[model samples]
Target: MFNWNLIGSIILPNIGGWAGAITTAGQMKNENGTAWYQTLEKPSWNPPNWLFGPAWTVLYCGMGFASYLVWRDCGGFTKKSILPLVLYGGQLVLNWTWTPVFFRLHQIGLALIHIFLLDAAAAACTASFIAVNKNTAYFMVPYLAWLCFATTLNYSIWQLNKDDGENYK
Candidate 1:
């Protein structure tokens, strides 16, 4: 039989993982000259938007599982629990902030800065999680890879559309 309480404890954080991705996706919007992102000069390697959702979904689930393992391995709520949770939550919040800054506010340049910070936060968080649970750290590998791709994409976007200002305030 499965431990219902154990499963429940991790459920909220797992949902947060999903929520972070969905929140970002919800912020995307299209424009007249291009389909939101279609007008932007993406690198040749840019993956389609559809790929992002599924990828993030899987990654977040992995993250939740990793965190759960850490929580379980430790005394449920120790300094260890707080460490990974704080780091993970911090990065997740930063993750959620990127899309609004980029798409909603039309601030790709600012978003670039935000994404860079988000990347660093995730790295720091990953390292901290590793101290508590190696699997937790490993779960973030996909997130790290995606962030690297995103950093390039963000920089490219900022460069491609500089000075236009378009709808930007």
Candidate 2:
């Protein structure tokens, strides 16, 4: 028999993740040829722009599945499930917020701070997931690793362009 709840759980997070991506991409397009991101200095190790979509797709799916596992293990929104789900929800919001803060608002420093909070929230969420189901926590590992890498990249970008005060506008 099929588990529609599991499928729905997995699909919801992916929808949230992709919706943010689409919105941010639209905002980027509306820049009127300014291409502000291209003007910023990035670390040599920064991945090509083409990589982000695919990377985020995988990460979002993994996290969605992980959340479903946690939700299933705890038997829906009962008291036991509240903490982990709340942590997961908090981090997801932080995840969606970073792109606009960095790419649209051009607030790299603020984005860096936001990502640090995201890293902590994700780590806490993973730990909470482990308490419910250890195996499910594994699904979050790659996303956590990616968050670390992104934090480094955000920090590098901030350092490289902190002095370009006038260009931030």
Candidate 3:
């Protein structure tokens, strides 16, 4: 009656989300809320700094639920399950690293590249998940949309401040 598998589907993706969030928090130990990010020449369309936390929370939960659906449909991590899950895991790592790449290291150009790859990986993950469950693939749509916005933002910031150098710290 406890429904451990059901709990796992909810908990597992949140764990992945938390891992990325915690790693980003650690990486941004000295950067978050500091002038470093605030001082950037962001685009006019850039959302306020306060918006990111909530946005990511929703996105992460959706991601977890989607992954769970795929995992359940695929009958766990068999050979059939490997590709989609691996792609999901890979994109998650890239997702976590982008914040540090941009905020901690102040490497806008490199961060742009990372995000582009992240976008691709996420898209592939979604496509792969479709074979397992339509809902799983649908769940990734918002994340992919967010990534498109983020990619544009990153590129704009990079272009805007390319001459500023890495003096952001």
Candidate 4:
């Protein structure tokens, strides 16, 4: 018998992650010739543009699997599961919103702030997951590490271009 619930639980976060990626990709297409993201002054340590999709794909899968573990351990949204799941959902929403704010709206500063909140929410989610399953919490560690890197990158971009009026461009 196929475990549909397990499959769905894993797919849910990937859907949200890919939806955001697709939406941001569409927005990038509207940039005519000079892509706004490429024009930004990123940090020297920033990864190449081509790397983001693959990196995000892996992160999303890990996060989705982590959520499934949590759900499985707590018996699918029982009272014991409520807090961690809510934290997970909240961080997911924050995760989805960051791309649009940074890429579409060109609000680098706002995106930095948003990512800070996401970092906190993800940390809380990981802690809650640890209570449910230590192995599940391990899955979130990479995502958390990536988020830290991303936050530093965002802050760097914001600082590097704060006076350039690139946010408006």
lDDT (CA) per prediction: 0.73, 0.84, 0.79, 0.86
Error (Å) of candidate 4 at residue 1 is 3.0
Clashes of each: 1, 0, 0, 0
- Can you list the residue pairs that collide in candidate 3? none
Candidate 1 TM-score versus the reference: 0.81
Badly placed stretches (over 4 Å) of model 3 are: 12-34, 167-169
Model 1: lDDT of residue 46? 77
Please give, for residues 1-169, the per-residue lDDT of candidate 1 as tens digits. Answer: 9976456645655565566555555445434434455556667777887787777667766666776776788778787578777887898788767766776566788888899999999998888778887777667788798899889988877776785667332
Query: How far in Å is the alpha carbon of 19 misplaced in model 3?
Result: 5.6
TM-score of 3: 0.85
- Give the distance in Å from residue 123's predicted Cα in candidate 2 to where it truly belongs: 0.6
Task: Name the regions of candidate 4 deviating beyond 4 angstroms.
Answer: 26-32
- lDDT for model 1, please: 0.73
The window of 10 residues in a row where model 3 has the poorest summed lDDT is 26-35
Error of 1 at 106 (Å): 1.6
What ordering of candidates by lDDT runs from best to worst?
4, 2, 3, 1
TM-score, every prediction: 0.81, 0.90, 0.85, 0.93
On TM-score, the candidate that comes out on top is 4
lDDT of 2 by residue, 12-53 (tens): 777766776875675444547646776778789989877988
- Of the two candidates 3 and 4, the one with more favorable lDDT, higher being better, is 4
